[model samples]
Target: MPPLNSTNNTESENVYNCPPIKHVPFPRSTSYYLQSEITDEFLQFAFSFLAASFQFLHLYRTVWWLPDTHMHQTVNFHLIDKSVALFLLILLSRRFWYSICITCVDLMVTKKRLYRMRLVLRYVFFFVITILLGICCVDIYFKHNNRVVYMCYPIIVYVIIFHFNIEPFLRTVYEGDMIYINGSPLHCCSTNPSAIRTEIDSLKKDFNNRFKQVIFTTLFNAYYGSVIPCFFVQNFVFYDIWITTFHMAFVLVGGFTTSTMFCLPANYCDVMHRAALHLGGWTRIDHRVASPATPWSKTTVWPNGSVVKYSGDFYRSHGLTTTAIPSNSYDNKFYMFFQNPAHIYTILSLIQVVIIVTQLFVLYFATEWHQMLSLGFLVLCNYFTLFKMIRDFFLTQRIYESESNIYARNLSN
Candidate 1:
């Protein structure tokens, strides 16, 4: 807007191809790097689909073809494995070509093209999985018996032995963990109560000085989001709390979008930040938290799939990270705001949270056993909400830093 030469040097250098935070480190497994060959949506989905198919394929062979063959390796299953591997190889090749396309083309060209390709791929796989899950969900989708507990397809999608066949595939492409709402989770996880409590009372306070908070933000969300629903199902006794809360689709697209009321400021300090200086102030902030230092600075090895290279500086104008270098964000945005899904998830979550919270309170007086259930659910719910809030707040901080980078580039030119 200015002469395009206006820049913020200090923030600029830190944003582009920047070093990892010396203090805070997050899970390398979750984020998608724009520059990484494997991180491309096509490549990722290819692998996920293949992985999913391989799972059920082998399962088919073992259960149907070689049920009683107690051997280390069997011809039937191996054949199935080989077939899947071949398919995987082909798909990977397809993605490899696409990744190359992203590498050489201008971002404007690349993004436009790649975005379409990704949408096509997203729907294709989602449809396939949905078809397979629809059968199971139909069997389970039921009304709550005046009891606050309930289950949905998203919850059961990855919940069984059959889940083994789907989970790896689902988890591989799922980067939606960090972007949770105050009530409903954007993504899903499998956890229990004891696990739920871990993130709540101890996390923020313990993580006050560590930006590792971001890394573990999803961890806590998963830990508790999953755990809370689990407690609801188990009645909170010495019961086995099998959890499958989070709405994967929401996670895939977007769950809920709380008001910018709690958005954090761009700078890392103990003061309230502007809800959004860029997005027409639809968001706002009052309290401020210090920039938790990035943890996981140890020189640790990462999965081959996690290594992504993006010149974050290039995307500064779009309000993305430049100083942070590209890392994993369990919060996947590609499938959400950019696509047709938009913020339907935000509205869904708000509705879900209100409904669930009220129903939960009503259940409080319904039965004492459920009262125990409510206690557990309460702990898990609050904890996950906190985790989601933390994720959203810090994510905004990142956006601001990225904006700063773009602001600098505009100035220099």
Candidate 2:
């Protein structure tokens, strides 16, 4: 047939490489923030690689309800798979923990004039602490197979929530670029700052206006939405995460970790909203006094008052950066609260502790819903923890690595 011959000719030409047209995919318009640099994507990839490897050396000896029954329907005793999984668990968990400490240190240290030796020492301090944690977990005093149910059962539940339920919900819901909650992938799309800011802001607005519309979307179809029926009712997975991670079946691990993770988003929302209110002038006037400023930060000199904070440079450039763009002073001001990051962080963290305490009772009494709830909770907790880890990394870059062109130009002189 003519069609078959034509197709064959095209294939032959492509195979022979007679200058066939390349089928390179065009980048999306929204990906404007992703410049020619491969650096950011590589760093994110490193973050994800570490996350996936978190399971390494994950051994806990605990008392078991049943001496030899499997909680996850099946158990893989294969040495290779076991080893890989364990490594992944540990590495991913470690990255999450490190993200917190690193963020704080970077923010604090970068603000001051510093030497290379101190910066290098700070990095060494981080690794030394991590190694100590690893050593403690390896001892036999902690490893009691008698309580494996107490150990593996809850962990299994957590993994289910992440890999099976909570993560899938986020991926299906957040369009364009998402890498679940715990892991990063090869595509550099997810961390392009401008795209992320736009997408997340849009989602939050959508959430604020019409979260109930969750039912009509394809994520909540007749079949898969049944996997999480609570979405049909509340139209969100956030509640499910809250209800599940507080299980008594996992008082020590689930209770502590779940509450910690849950606070991350709630805490972020509170902090950002507080800063937004100040920038938007919601605290002063009844009407929204509009301004062309980002929600997270803004700086306004009193129209008549002197901004006596800096020297001649502040007055010279008409309040713009040496790059001739608007100065990021507002952004810097918002983060200045990092000396504390606001009271709501403490409040949410404390409330998270209370919820875990309540969960202890729920575990002892609520038997029927235990497995499902615990599993769902575990997923939510890990997802939140993963999210917090990413935020921690990004915030550090914003505060520390962002070029202070003012400082740089002066330094060169």
Candidate 3:
């Protein structure tokens, strides 16, 4: 009876004096500009322009499939040209179509329907492209006598492979951040922490698998590295070397984009890892045993039975960053890769630099104006690659050094 009386007294006193503790979550930055200071419209325009420019070069090359003679020009579209054109049209139309679909999903559709529609659209598009790809491959192979077909066959193959792999590639490189930004609730609203945690775990697995695929694809796809050189090897001189140079430049641009895509996912992972460390939840340890880094790691259990959530600074720090620490330290392959991104980067840069220098030297020795112009373009593109790679390399090294310092400090404690 005394205990009951004391409990009642305490409850009545507290009820009169205190209010319930309400969770006020940190407001997540909703600005797409968070990732790039540039506006989304600008980014979209840049992407559309690049896509059109590159595909237009491929289209221009396909024109060669038409018979060189004037008499043949009077006929309707040739089978090879028609097929390649249809494929290119399908390819080129995809980005705009995708943008429309995304806009519809965001503005006009319900969440449940949006998810189902995305799955349906993904599989349907893949099935359609696969059929078109096969047809194009057969048509192009049958017309192998055309040097344009020979040169462009490799390009077709590159497209097919990239198409099949693109979903996974994009999921890793950008979708996680997109999902995080989109799912974020207003500060006053509450979300299901468990649901967020589950989604993040799924994202981690998806990212790991997709990132591995990107690495494998980049390494195994020899034609990507060899495309520009093959023109020289075949000794196939074109009437307009400028066109040829542009065509090859298109391929170089594609390779550069692919290389850039590979880096994005890795950088995202590193950003999250750093965020975890900064929030004081994650610890650096030897790679034999590694735990998943999560925002909840920083959660502080308070005396009053409340938990402190991760801060806005943690989320902001992770956005729009470059370089990465491998998330799964236990993964020997990834551990080695992350341990020295600089070394791997240097090797890739030197190989590309050598290739560019060789081509430049050859172009220089040739007195043709087109060759000289090609030399300038090659230098410009290669220099961009060099700058990007070196910058990322140093950034990664800094991440590693900071991590090492953190671990050392902890050990000394």
Tell how far residue 18 is off in model 1, in angstroms. Answer: 34
Q: Against the true structure, what is every candidate's RMSD?
A: 21.2, 22.7, 12.5
lDDT of 3 by residue, 240-327 (tens): 5454555455444434444443434224444333332222221234323323222322111111111222331121112111112224
**Per-model CA lDDT versus the true structure:** 0.30, 0.31, 0.40
Residue pairs with colliding backbones in model 3 are: none
The digit string of per-residue lDDT tens for model 1 on 182-223 reads 211222111221222222223222223122222222232232
Ranking by lDDT: 3, 2, 1
Q: Which window of ten consecutive residues has the lowest lDDT sum in model 1? A: 275-284
TM-score of model number 3: 0.47
- Give the worst 10-residue stretch by lDDT in candidate 2: 316-325
Residue-pair clash count for candidate 2: 28
lDDT of 1 at 254: 17
Measured by lDDT, the strongest candidate is 3
Question: Once model 2 is optimally superposed onto the true structure by TM-score, how far is the C-alpha of residue 44 displaced, in angstroms?
Answer: 20
TM-score of each: 0.23, 0.24, 0.47
* lDDT of candidate 1 at residue 374, scale 0 to 100: 33
